[model samples]
Target: MKGLGPQIPTKAPPKQSPHFRLYARKYAKSNAWTLKVKNPEHSHDSIENIMVHPAFRKFNEQETSQTAQMSESLLMPRKIWAQLCSQRESDRPVILQYIYNQIKKVKKDKVQGRRPIDALIDTFKEENFVWSSERDA
Candidate 1:
């Protein structure tokens, strides 16, 4: 699902906007999901703006691998975005939001089912690190 571009506030009671709707229906027999369009007459000005939309924007395989590796190394999202942008000059520039979302997903995958603190503790143990905590009175 892509954004409908920037929105402009209107003082009028009724704001003019496209009424496009899509529905996903599950087949009763097969339990398969199928998409159905309610209205096809959607008004969109330009297709180029889709490149900036986070939902529609995508990273290539190389960029995806790089993002995963960098995320594992604990690199900041902004730095990762800059590195990706500098690596290539494509028609579609990398969106910072996309990078941030990707990094979040990567980190979540790394943590898997374990709690974040548990994962950190496991990492520390793997590295032979030590820490101690004291109760406050």
Candidate 2:
């Protein structure tokens, strides 16, 4: 009567979109959060892709504290990285550069805008370490 088969428009429809949108909300009464996914399909598989992401390589709180303690103890970043890798058997190994950066960050925080020598002197004073310097005639 009208048409024998489906109709194809003169203009092509829009291409398949790859965007994935996820929304999260927390209710005032509940301690849990709810996640709403607009597009459940993911662009890539997480299992194979997660290890390559930089965010996945970040240290957790415990690792950060351990790194700080090790750095304060004068352990080299490479050794610290090795120790961290040995402690964790994750798919992504702890990077040496990350260890170096973390140690640098810890040291910077410890210095707190003051010079390193000043911080060291403060630490020595706190620990009651005595040092006397003789004036040259």
Candidate 3:
């Protein structure tokens, strides 16, 4: 009679790379957007395949990259946002509102201030430009 065999620990398989996961998620979202916009009759797999073609793949990559950069900028910490608002007056109100909204979503207190539109006018000075005689005529 054989003694009890040594126990072997079983572990789950390693996860997929982050790049592949990002690619797959972006591809799925883009495919859905395309289907909605064009009302196509293709299956999900077929649409996914088409969307992964070299041309569409490159386009998707660029779009995803740009979106990532934009989100990173938009999600900067409050201190960073304040610094940016101080440096870029034109962007202050929009940036402030963005930060406020982010805070508000998590039920945090927000600094009460003027609306984004008011900030825009204050930042840009809407009525101070002088028009040329020819253009006015």
* lDDT agreement of model 1 with the native: 0.80
Error of 1 at 43 (Å): 3.5
State which candidate has the highest TM-score: 1
CA shift of 71, model 2, Å: 1.4
In the range 1-137, model 3's lDDT, one tens digit per residue, is 24679756588666443221212223555564222223233333345445434443231333334334444466554554455445443321323444454444432211127655455455455566543322234
- The 10 consecutive residues of candidate 3 with the worst lDDT sum are 17-26
- Give the winner by TM-score: 1 or 2: 1
What stretches of model 2 exceed 4 Å from their correct place?
Answer: 1-48, 132-137
Worst 10 residues of 1 by lDDT: 9-18
Give one digit per residue, the lDDT tens place, for model 2 in 38-135.
97787655676677788988889999999999998999888888898889967676878888888889879988999887888888889999975454
Supply the TM-score for candidate 1: 0.60
Relative to the true structure, how large is the alpha-carbon lDDT of every model? 0.80, 0.83, 0.42
Clashing pairs in 2: none
lDDT of 1 by residue, 1-137 (tens): 24888766656565456578999989999999999887677755556566676554589889999998898888988889889988976667788877888888887888898989888887887898987545469
Q: Which candidate is the best by lDDT?
A: 2
